[model samples]
Target chain A: MREVAALAGVSVKTVSRVVNQEAGVSSAVRERVSSAVSRLDYRPNLAASNLRRAGARTGLIGALVQDLSNSFSAGVLRALEDTARAHRTGVLATSLDEGVERERELVHDLVTRRVDGLVIMPASTRHDYLVSELRTGTPAVFVDRPPRGVDADSVVVDNASGARSGTEHLLARGHRRIAGLFHLTQIVTVQHRIDGFRSAHEAFGLVPDPRLVVTDISSAEEATRVVDRLLALDDPPTAIFAARNLLATGAVRSLAQHGLRRSVALVGFDDFPLADLLDPPLTVVRQDVARIGRTVGELIFQRIDGDTSPPRHVVIEPTLVVRGSGEIRPTA
Target chain B: MREVAALAGVSVKTVSRVVNQEAGVSSAVRERVSSAVSRLDYRPNLAASNLRRAGARTGLIGALVQDLSNSFSAGVLRALEDTARAHRTGVLATSLDEGVERERELVHDLVTRRVDGLVIMPASTRHDYLVSELRTGTPAVFVDRPPRGVDADSVVVDNASGARSGTEHLLARGHRRIAGLFHLTQIVTVQHRIDGFRSAHEAFGLVPDPRLVVTDISSAEEATRVVDRLLALDDPPTAIFAARNLLATGAVRSLAQHGLRRSVALVGFDDFPLADLLDPPLTVVRQDVARIGRTVGELIFQRIDGDTSPPRHVVIEPTLVVRGSGEIRPTA
Candidate 1:
């Protein structure tokens, strides 16, 4: 690298800039560096070992999703890994487990191991923790959720719009008494989805009963209990909108136990495995996970290849799948 | 390392073993090596460099499974990763899509990168290709299947016995005409399951109709088609045994479409997510994935820590879960 720098009549910093494909380098200067690099056959190691310095790549990508075991996250991971595999890069997979500290720790671990870049589904409400790594020129793309307190590339679904479509689907079916089951987590996605649900009711010139909106539904068991309580109310809802996958499953179980699976209408927010094979099947807001994952890979690789443009936040559209359950009549 | 070896009055090889905590070293020698290591404050770069000698540890573990998106494989990976995380180690995950060349290529890549250990769910019919890595002192543990052509640590469920149990469950219900649907791929586990299916019929002093046994059944769609064909036969099986999870899913869909879900008895080899949510529910032989994963982790880590004992093959027991589907009496 020093020889190349001297041969090109440039400083080591200039050589690094050219080698890393950093933006803002002059074309003429780049040509000179390219000539020197070709003449000397210099391999720049982006990751800091002397022998590895010959290549500008580390051949490793870090994937920090919330949970790799979950179907949604797992599908996205499969896409990312397949894409990376075609390019001959290995992925370091981690489960964030909804712990901010754990996410930060794993990220730090991957960074210290000198992975070329990262794909993250951040657990923290704020991403100020990532500023240092980004400044150090590490490439990253956030998936599932947008980053807060820091600028970065992101690929996410239009949660609010998707939720609004689902809610309106029920409203159009003549279900005036609709109940909502939602997660109480601080995740920004929940808020966006709730907003869409309210907006759907507002558009129809109706008010959603505050008491019908149940929060703090975490696990499938909890979702089942929440639905059970809703049904036990004096004026039970004619339809229910489950805001998450597990919640929908729990609702299914509860409905089955109460012999309401065929009577009460239900629409879920996310598509899950075998959702189409259920007795009445399940209607859901389906996001193209593979497309989202691919887009995320593209952005992260672009940054790795030295595109220092403004950060991109790509919002993918979600479509409503109207299977039997969601299309059920109010049956008043 | 040289200084530590000299101070401990041992060879550099002994120093390496002591530092890596390999077994078979005398306690006195281990104590001396520890004291010498403390005195020198040695930090062994398990992963070698141009500066590092060849055959050093990379402190990374490679996990190659069939499909990480599938629930069974995903569950195993989650458990393995959780175990690795506690030890401050990272995991490199790969999905082997039934391509032998792909599996070999990935193993080569990981070996070249000098990962310290590996956990593989082989896609190849034989694993003789892994001989070189095992010979080079790299720790490996095979999951879901035992390694062939070369010896290595492994943790697998008893597929044959599990299948036998599921088959007998249906036979006990007086279903003489039982159909079999299994993966076409020559996965050893699947072969064992087929053997068990044949064994069950033999035990009952009856011969299985060759026409009723379908092979090369790959996906859920294929399973459904196979079941539909069976039902259309002149003497359709009164009970069906699908030997895989996806196969079970397809069978359920086919039965529902033909309106035979309640009438025709069904028992599957593997349990899947939401099996209980099906109308009559699904009965299956369930493998303890968490235990398999944990066992694989233990064996691999043991090898990494210098326990060069004979390759230990651990066989986990599978249990038969009786839901409604398996207990149904044959109609007509």
Candidate 2:
């Protein structure tokens, strides 16, 4: 500011008034100061200025997801970023990697940076730790899961219903023995999906074989191993309902390797890019990730804009996309 | 500081000394001040302190990529974020969306935020605008594309050679009429891939059909339309070399729709996650995106850590991964 004032041959206060667009600065002096500012390439410290001004925005938000590399999380982040960009706000994205401690740490870090708002796909079961931050007026919107032990806006898919519909689709296809592959049951979403899978069997008045239900499948590779084990069983499942995208990928690989792509019915939860291009075109219970992300973006921005409304929970209904795979009939 | 002092029954200067970790602060006073600070959840604004201290890091960096939703960009971002996390730095990632103006605006915004460093997959043809920022001591490393009109460290895959290898692999499989699908010709990487396509045909003592060489292809849908038009040609190419991943996806869709998945050979430049799972399994010139990301991360952090050497350019060699599509014989 001093350098700009000196270059413009004006007082530092005059330069400040020009920079801040304050009234009472003459056109000639304002032009001179502006030219000097441009020439000097001076960027006023927004972080510092934002500190002094109440209700000043930082023009940046933080998005914490389970994993940025995963298709679902990446898609959600992309949607949030697009929405944020429309408001001229940038997003700082980080992956929690399903670490509860990491989520807390990252939330703390983003809070320390004073992000205008937050969009979190939380790994932690409870978000009580965020109460103080919420109380202090840093609004946050949770995605993919509801916040436990705290009041916050959230957008989540109807995971249990989506899973039930997918399982029911396979059962209606006359597949008597259906296998279920899932992520860790500790995750609320995963547990909800498991509940849906069980409810579908109950609706059909058929008991799901406990031996065919596999959990704790974290990666596609792990899912593949689980599928291989199930396939080798004496009473192998005639169909598979993968409750996660990665698990679905594993099931696809296993079915392909076993030359059973045409015989075994399969349905996956969570649609991914190229799902339609896969052999038999993967059948999926598709959650509108883009919509979920947009909802989260909207909720967080509203809070940032000082909307003092009570927290709202939004549950998006997932749709069944019947591609070739789920339509496959049992050969037995 | 005053609030902490009041809570801890200490002088403001004593709290400041403890927070700054300056010498001459008694451990008892420091412990009392720290407890009070924790009790109040008083986060010392690092942004404000960073402005006052020379060489103080904001513990944040900026990453500007083409798009976050795309597999390549997302993979790179995930790797970079992992590396930055190890260094206790957060990355604020933004997508350029192939807009030069957006790139400039985002760069200026990141600069204004006083990020410690930057990693850019540049959209602009000329980056003389970044010269000022670089001169101002904000380190940046370019990725996927090299920086132009300015000196900066860059990590890029061998585009020309990668394209050439993919084309040659098709030619070796008795494909005389090969279609070349590429991105925008203005992009340096796309242009280099086109050059490689032409050179490979030249090496084989053949001239590529002008009608078969398509450019300006952006999305999978566009690529599919282009492929449909090419297939409608009376003299259609037997093989396709898709220079971009989306173009490959389009080509795959077209072939599948036309019931030519078994007969039409196709090779893609960049490999995607589901490439191997597609019908006929996509053959590709695979650039190690993870490695490229890691290389970019290392270079940028090194620059941020005061490595003032001349700008270094790193080129990674791409490898050919033959699944099934590229090995198909041209049955004219």
Candidate 3:
């Protein structure tokens, strides 16, 4: 406050730096300001004061999440908060809702807030806005999915390899009929997972059954319908690879309804809540959500700190969590 | 922007108001400014322009959540987003991690950004900071729990009634032995829920058992240990109440480990994803997350519009969803 600065014999700007706990304020000046603050009982409106100073940041960061209900996004948001807190920044999160228009609107909203940087988990086909932001030197880091048709720093999981390995594990157990159940996101990550699934079949010299792959169904209700249709076929796949958590839940529900819990093998893409507590625990291709969050946080900060190198895409490895669902023996 | 204003023969403030869609500017003037913007190809940094105005807002609202990982928090946040989008305002979210100091810091952050208003889920034991903000006539609505030690507009669940009703459901089922589980937060909502649980026992001519209550344990690992201790007791309760979703998961894990799924009836506070898909399906008290979010959003907007009436605390009723878990027929 002006009163504190007057008592401390420092500029209001200097008072602001000290109040915000920002670096570059001398210790002597900080001490004087503290004493002045105590003596005057000057409870400053710190943010308002910062706005009056030059180079004062809004202290807001934009986080673009795909779906808030998803456990993975929830975990990532938590991790991102932990990272953002250390830098004295706060997150403004938006759920993309799997719509490009919604994602664009949220991005526009963040930009209009003048957020110093962004951590976007994009679900859009065209990333022109991101490219333009990059050209204008807006600090940003794409997470979960990369910015297509643009060069930007990204933190992604090795979905293709994880899916491939999971399929191979099922095949190695002598099960040739494997199904791939995935969400209907247009992101490249989905394609990679599908690629991995197909590559596994290729490695085993088995022809891929196109009917076993399900896509474009958003909600659990639709997923249930799709899985039911797939299973009603004369020869349903013995093992199912659910590409996402929601799809996996739908498949599990169908399995339970059909009274085939132990008979049909399943390996889900993302982990879900209470997966381990089920009668036959779910096996999932587990992506290290916390690590991915941390890495993306680190990458964004690095980019913000004048890292002028080409945009880097960092891929984290996923592990196969072998549980009862993936190891079920097929009935002849 | 100055050039456009000069060309249009208008003040910079008038030009800004016209350009940014703020009220008070005439339609003719707005059209003139729009034409000038088109002619000059002058794009305004909407976020900065809104801030530069004296009384106009940046079309942004801040939401402070206690924890994003919690299902309750996430559900509320998603609903808030939907409401905000409908109102054409962008939401800036921050996670407080249930720390008073952190909540204080985030409030300051939003204030500095000059967010039009705030929808805060306060974590502080006292609401001195919020009181100060309210004194300054800053529009804010507290959600999930009322602001402690401060009078303000709030949207909260009837935790006591919900818990009491839940306990009564168990009591009516001929089970004298029942245990209560709750997260440890100095929050009044938690206490209210605990009170209701106690009230149920008191009504049934039974004394509250100290050994049957667990508090100060929130994390899954901690809950796991607490549930283990509860189950190992010489006279373990026939029914158990886990306060929140994570605790429910922990209790389920503990139950599964002991192979006592159907033997002991369980009820959880919050409904979670795939609660019904489980082997026995979970019984839970479901909070109206969407209704709560909408009410909080409306309250914040009302406050922003200068609603200075006596503070109102709106309590939404929660519903008890009886699934297979609580409906199990106890065989003595």
Candidate 4:
């Protein structure tokens, strides 16, 4: 502190004020002090200071999601940020990219930085690894997926019910031959959605063709290829149920190329931007993403505010949006 | 360490290995130790430890963008994350939402947390405030925009040229009256794009009507409203040049609603996901977002690795993607 004050030609009190980000210091003086502090590589031991000040917080939260590039994850993050900012807190967000090891690593990193709380959309099947962190009083709220092996506050869309409704919509339109395009089956949400797809078919005393049910469709391009192959089959599906946004996008592309967009009925699980503006207009089972994000934010903040209540599990219901694509009747 | 070992019934060496994330510790043992550490609130002073070891890093970087929900910013963040992971680093990503004060505050927050480097798409018009941080040896790379009032590594798309090309394309299609839907003029890129729009008109000895060139459109819905109002005029535009993705989306919606989708030509500045799949397809001036991200990542990493060379400014040229929309002929 003395060195910074001396170098900046300011009083030690002024330097302290600048360093503490307190008001009443001129911009020039603050800049000078900051420059001096930087040149000397002087970092105040914030952790030590926070420890000394009772109830002092780092005012930083950690958020780990599946992918930052995906609209679903991005929307969740944005909402969390909005909530955090209201409390004068900052969020440290990172993507796990479906890597369990990466999730653990990032959780560890964030904890080391002494973040006040955590909001995680786990890539791991079991969150037994987080047991230690939770025990240490690091409040956590899971989003998009529920936590397994450890109890935690969670906000998730009713994937199975949503998928069932979308599938049932096509089935109600008299389409028995429907193709199911899905993401990785290992994901709990995906498995639930698959179950819903099966249950919807069972309601009509029918079963989905095993050949038409494709899993592990990772990218839009891959989904397009899968749909193209399905179309080439001896018995092409008359309707398609895409379990994810990218999968739906691929299906749209393939259907467009095959010139069967108007003929084949399609219902996607998740709604995306401009879904209603497409040629035939896409029908989807739309998750209330904003509400989900807001719910997760509120839950996480509540936990951080020392709520010792039992873990709350929230399931937001999705609604099926009817448009031109899903309303298409089977030509066959 | 002693208390943690005693609580977990593990040797000090075992606890050390677990804490350092070194190999050879059993999962059960590691879990026990971690739990004990959490219960005891035993935090290893990583900052002190890092200081003891030469060239030690916290293995974290900070990224601040305008909006994470926007595809452009999200895509850049994802690419940066990919590159960061290759070097076994975690990125702490945040959204500024075009708030200048928020940018300064987050930068201060990240600095206090001791991030090794920064990737910023600044919301501030001038970054003279970052001088002290730079002097303190924080490597930063500006993305999507250039740094003002301070010299730093920057990677930006050629906004003017891209906009010029798009406007010229519409002009070449014999559209004399073209409406320009733009974002906030305060943004440097927006200003550059507006200049390009004017220059394109000038090439044909024409000047755009100030009434047709609308600015300060903050949302797609707003753009739609603006386009609708413009369409109701006696001298309606035959073509539309949207300066951003969201603005273009708004124009597309309004055009569709007005039953003029095929009649009015439209070209957007930034290409978005599913642009090719839209009705009549969206023509755009596409920026190589991945490449820009990679370049920023490379430059920041190089600086972190002690590269003290003069700050490099890399401007990536945007490409005009001629699709169905931009090729539409004017009927007026």
Question: What is each candidate's DockQ, to 2 decimals?
Answer: 0.25, 0.72, 0.45, 0.47
State the weakest 10-residue window (summed lDDT) of model 4 chain A.
Answer: A43-52
Please give the TM-score that candidate 4 achieves against the real structure: 0.89
Model 3 docking tier (incorrect/acceptable/medium/high): acceptable
Question: Sorted by lDDT, highest first, which candidate order results?
Answer: 2, 4, 1, 3
> Per the 3 Å backbone cut-off, how many clashing residue pairs does candidate 4 have?
0
Whole-structure CA lDDT of model 4: 0.89
Error of model 1, residue B251, in angstroms: 1.2
On lDDT, the candidate that comes out on top is 2
Which portions of model 2 show Cα errors greater than 4 Å?
B20-24
Over B1-332, each residue of candidate 4 has an lDDT whose tens digit, in order, gives 88899999989878889988999888999999999987887767554456556778867799999898999999898889888878777787888888999899888777766778999999998999998777767889999989999989999999999999999999998999999998988889999999999999999999999999999999999999999999999999999999999999999999999989899899999888889888789999999888888888899899989999999999999999977988899985
lDDT of 1: 0.86
Q: Per-residue lDDT for A1-332 in model 1, tens only?
A: 89999999999889889987999899999999999986765655322442445535668899998888888889999988878876778889999878899988877667656677999998888999888666546788999889998899999999999999999999999999999988865888888889989999999998899999987788899999988999999999999999988899999999999999988999999898889888789999988888887888888878877899999999999999988999889876
> Comparing candidate 1 with candidate 2, which one achieves the higher TM-score?
2
- Residue by residue across B1-332, what tens digits does model 3's lDDT show? 89899888898888878866889888888888888876765656654544455677656798888778777888898888887877777787778777889788777667656677888898787887566655545688889888777777889999999899888888889777888888874878889989999999899988768999888777777787888888899988788888777888888888888888888888889888888877699999989887898888888877777787888889899999988887665557
Candidate 4: CAPRI quality band: acceptable
Residue B209, model 1: Cα distance from true site in angstroms = 0.9
User: Cα-based RMSD of the predictions, in order?
Assistant: 10.6, 1.4, 4.1, 4.3
Ranking by DockQ: 2, 4, 3, 1
Order the candidate numbers by TM-score, best to worst.
2, 4, 3, 1
- Model 4, residue A140: distance off in Å is 2.1
CAPRI quality of model 2: medium
